[model samples]
Target chain A: MSTERGLFDLTCADFGLIRGITESWDHLLSRSIAAVREQFIEQCGLIAQAEALPRIAGRILGLMVFDGKDYSFSEIAEELQISRGSVSSSVSLLTAMGVIERTAKPGDRQDYFRLSEDPYTTFFARARNRAERAHKTIQETRDAVPKDKREIRSRLKEYETFYATLIKALDSGT
Target chain B: MSTERGLFDLTCADFGLIRGITESWDHLLSRSIAAVREQFIEQCGLIAQAEALPRIAGRILGLMVFDGKDYSFSEIAEELQISRGSVSSSVSLLTAMGVIERTAKPGDRQDYFRLSEDPYTTFFARARNRAERAHKTIQETRDAVPKDKREIRSRLKEYETFYATLIKALDSGT
Candidate 1:
């Protein structure tokens, strides 16, 4: 009976050690994951700001794009540390921009949002269109100016040419 | 004698009319040119803000790129309607970023600023490097996470793949 008691004690000690190891592993893993998510959100903010999108909207879209998963409105707001109302409006705006879309989960009343199939392609296409229009506007202005305003006319021509080159570059693709 | 005087008066009146038309044309041309410059500056501000650049610096760079000429510090300040101190710091920052360079004109004491030889190419190259670093960081995190966390690991993998595709796309030119 004494020998049996010793075996039982050893078994309990080993199990507790294993549990401790697992718990520590989980803690470290969660910390690292949080860091990655934070970094990703920041990157998305930078790109979105560059593209002239609002910060919160960019963050929501960024989270969806990187995670590639559908999120409920509350989930996104909580994850991003933003107000629920802000998330609601930003998601709506992103949906309208074709950067993200809403889907309903079966048997669940909460709406879910996910990135569009090809957000970057759509964004770049819009940028190309804007450049083309700017080029046309510059061309018209150049034509309207008199010949003697050589310096100003030359500047407009350069802009027209640069935009033309840029559009051509964009069209060629990678 | 009377006929000669009348003819002279008619000639003078015609000459004055021609001068007035020329001056009016010049006035309209300058105003339109100013408008174009203002619009271009505004566009640059938008793109710069999107890219996390200082707005004034972006405007100055945009002016140089479109005009394809060097400008003195005062000229840039005056043209953009910004303070000289802002222009000074913005130009310095842009020069450090490799988007613009300082040039000296023969016989002119003041420094001039102009766009770098290929600003867009340089800018895209920097962007590619940043993407590569992000991919590596994500890869490390993905490896560190436990296999049971399939959702988190999968998100990191997707990000890795997307950045790889983006760098490839950026590398393919323009």
Candidate 2:
């Protein structure tokens, strides 16, 4: 037998993650994978390494991709062992961003939800739309702000222009 | 007058940023900036949008640069309005990474600290050291683990090799 432990083979009993994961009713490694995966997709700029917000957000998104079936609000909250309020808010945000679909399930009063199969495209669409608006606003500021007092606006304009042009080129070429 | 907020004219508020330098300390925008800036410097790879972390870390470092003199733990904490524990930890991490120096002032029991110049070089040294160890560990695992069971190790080896070489080159450079 090897002296080292397999990444997933080790139990919560062997580590604090297991203790927390089990108590939280989650698989720690699985969650870590999800969190890491989210960062790869969004690179939203690093935040506190102490708390993995990406993984927290990822788990919520991953859970929505539940087995071919749409889930209700209560069912999701129960499964994730999280508050209904949290699920509601996260779901609302995801829905507004078009990465999750929400509708009434047969014989259910609560909204039913499912992950968007093309979450990458949908998510990017939402992000791109926001980026475009920001770019426009920044450009507007650049034009209207007095020349002597527009350093920040100039910086914002540079960023918006770079990203806007880059994404457009990507869309056209891809 | 154009309908856009002009330069940093001592008093313009950003939608997400505190407009005036004298904006109320109690405002959410100001608090958000303080928090974001804090996370930014401590954790690298942050972009400008990291309006909080990078900004906070930069400001703290900047403040230390301005003083160019040792500050008691309490003094720095009070200036930033953060708790002593946080100051202690941030300072400790900075010291370990060689970003700051710690010492006891003459005839004073309390330890005082100041930012160490050329923190960029020191920061990369710490990071490069970490990357080397992680790469070596992963390379060892790839060599030992069963072929059918070592896909993660294998992929890690490829990536680690690429990064290790890159970091090594950077270290040897300049």
Tens-place lDDT digits, model 1, residues B88-135: 899998888888899999999999988776665665666567667767
lDDT of 2 at B91: 75
Strongest candidate by TM-score: 1
Question: Which pairs in model 1 have colliding backbones?
Answer: A49-B50, A50-B50, A50-B51
Instruction: Give all candidates' CA lDDT scores.
Output: 0.73, 0.51
lDDT of 2 by residue, B43-141 (tens): 321321232233334445544643356788888878778777777776776677676788788888888887665444553354356546545544543
Using alpha carbons, what is the TM-score of model 1? 0.66
Regions more than 4 Å wrong, model 2: A1-58, A65-69, A103-110, A117-174, B1-59, B65-86, B97-112, B117-174
User: What docking tier does model 2 reach?
Assistant: incorrect
* TM-score of every candidate: 0.66, 0.38
